[model samples]
Target chain A: MSEGPGAKVYVFDAYGTLFDVHSAVARHRETIGPSADRLSELWRTKQLEYSWVRSLAGRYRDFWSLTEDALDFAAAKIGGIAPEARATLLDAYRALDAYPEIREVLGELKAQGASIAILSNGSPAMLDAGVSAAGIGDLLDDVLSVDELEVFKTDPRTYALVTRRFGVTAEDVSFQSSNRWDIAGAKAFGFRCAWINRAGAPDEYAELTPDRTLCDLRGLLDASE
Target chain B: MSEGPGAKVYVFDAYGTLFDVHSAVARHRETIGPSADRLSELWRTKQLEYSWVRSLAGRYRDFWSLTEDALDFAAAKIGGIAPEARATLLDAYRALDAYPEIREVLGELKAQGASIAILSNGSPAMLDAGVSAAGIGDLLDDVLSVDELEVFKTDPRTYALVTRRFGVTAEDVSFQSSNRWDIAGAKAFGFRCAWINRAGAPDEYAELTPDRTLCDLRGLLDASE
Candidate 1:
């Protein structure tokens, strides 16, 4: 029941942590058929894989293009998707459904005199559309994208953006990411990290451990206290 | 019927290219139950994922440890693996089976006076054991490990090691890998790349296409022509 470690800035990972990435596929479940979930999972997997591979290769492509490329791969694996349906899926991605508690949590965080922002691999335009559609744009003070540095998450430079933008040391920032790899990168970079483990997935990155593991953003409010 | 692109040196990726990465799990199929193949697939996926993430985060762990970490993840996901069984799997990995055509193809390439080597994300010890077990050490001009650079493949630096070691330009090297991403990296780095598409999985990284796509190493012989 004690108060958690206080951080000067709370930076949340945009996709999966705030907006539900799978919602785009869910919206067109009928069109995708029984393999919809499988398609969505593959799409998400390839998106991250492409990001990491591209980052390591120093081939910087915007996340939007990467998202389309991932969708193409997933669609191919799951069977051909109609061009119209694929377009619909991509459009749906532009305004993905935010998690149920996103608005309430961001409102609470803002009311608590804490600085909040998003640090994401999403391109600026994608993040802008999603944040505005999710109606949390007013709650967040800044939305940082990797497109600025032409790299993706898990890169030290990507994590450095949060510290650089907010003008705070990594120790003064609490980084929250639903992606364990992102958590590992941020934690390794010296941020007080919280892993938003919504799926109860198994642990990874044996050497670097997150500062806290939370099931949802509600747990973040406690950290601010 | 026609000679393919000739290069000064022929470089290959180690795991999945020369050796069978899943052969280790095949050795312990009964212990793993029906999920043996699943476990192996997940293990390979996580192994590569860990490598990419670690490389991006600038946190380098030897491929051997990462291999173990990946196995642990796959085992935990599929269910608890007995400690002794786990150790057995790890031992099996140290000397994975070389692909049936590895010897013949490497011999042919070397016979034609091509300088052939391995440029891999594997640690020195892992590559050493696998090459010795496969009995292809004499056929190789050198075996390069990312351990020296402390970064995994897809990083241009990993590919650069080949050019540096052989004292050849990237254009003077022919890099082959069963991994599409590795091929993409090699191609982007200016190597005459060949994708050993053993699985015939969907193409990715749309812009950076390999110079050739071959089903096996036998096709590599044609390139040496």
Candidate 2:
């Protein structure tokens, strides 16, 4: 099949979609024991929930602080993590490794002339750390953080950063996220979305569909095609 | 206990705090089959997630529509609910059973000279149906729907409705919810909060604590005492 008109800008959600958020907890599995996965799940749940809650309340806390807060809540449930272990896990978060396919996918998008970027709730410092740590900082054209607006993702204003910075309409932007809610929100905000369902989870949001569904970044190129 | 200086207004969260949200699915457990609990869990999760997502995006659909949309999403995950069964479930939702303690607590609060009201993301119609069905309409001084603001709760503006309607500061309003997020939001917005932890779940939001933690409405009286 012929390649359709390519997107002007391709925006990727940073945390679970690109960087493996669970990696931090997984790296310390020996210390965390069997509850590693459960703790990771709860930590992620609280992290996102806090972002939404803070956004709704119009009280913005940077993602780094929010992540720490989520970890505190999750640690409490699992009978707590040692301070040294907690420090190690949090340090690992700032340098979360990208999924195996991320670099190649970004290369392809760049070769195809799509201006690739990240729009995340991560603070500028955290995003910088992740991008540099993953060695992909040179590949991205821009990094947008909701910290500028003191809000979190799924907020239309947060998504508008892409349009303003890239000089493209929402439709001209192709946004990808592993999050069903993020996909729905981006679709509702008029972006051409590619939902990266890495976990093969059932679709749990109605009325809105991403323009594309990819099992991984490898499928992103095909979806764009 | 001398009522300890009764609050100017007692604002309750409608869905899980006052009405049992799972009652609709529970009523038709046979129809929902083995997935009854799972379906109910997903429905409630999606319902709240949609409200927060919509509010963040500034695209507000009434909670009634959001509820149906959430059900659609939930049913899809559970392999879909038939139209007739779906109708039955939705209809049942309109008249959810109030928690056994709700009426008695409202009566006690009223007798103590505290203004009792509901502040929910529910559309006025849904609140009306539940209130009327439960025969507690007369006990409530006012029903505040976030529909007027076209936003969901946790948005400080939604909580501001209490102050606007009752001519009271947030400190004078005692807000209660079974949802931890609601309690945290209310606390952050400056309301004296009572978190009805009916399920005894761990408090996931950090730093913000409810003024009272009650197993049920019976404890509300004691908390005041």
- Candidate 2 on B4-82: residue-level lDDT in tens? 4545688999999999999999999998899999899889988888899888877788999989988988898888888
| Tens-digit per-residue lDDT, A112-190, candidate 2 | 8889899998999999999998889878999999899998978888899988887778888889999988998898899
Per-candidate local distance difference test: 0.89, 0.88
Off by over 4 Å in 2: A1-7, A27-35, A78-85, A223-225, B1-7, B27-35, B80-85, B223-225
Interface RMSD of each: 0.8, 2.1
Q: Please identify model 1 stretches exceeding 4 Å from their true place.
A: A1-7, A223-225, B1-7, B223-225
Question: Where is model 2 chain B poorest over a 10-residue stretch in terms of lDDT?
Answer: B1-10
Q: What are the TM values for chain B, all candidates?
A: 0.95, 0.96
**Cα deviation of A135, candidate 2, in Å:** 2.8
**Error of model 1, residue B67, in angstroms:** 0.6
DockQ for each numbered candidate: 0.78, 0.56
Clashing residue pairs, backbone N/CA/C < 3 A, model 1: none
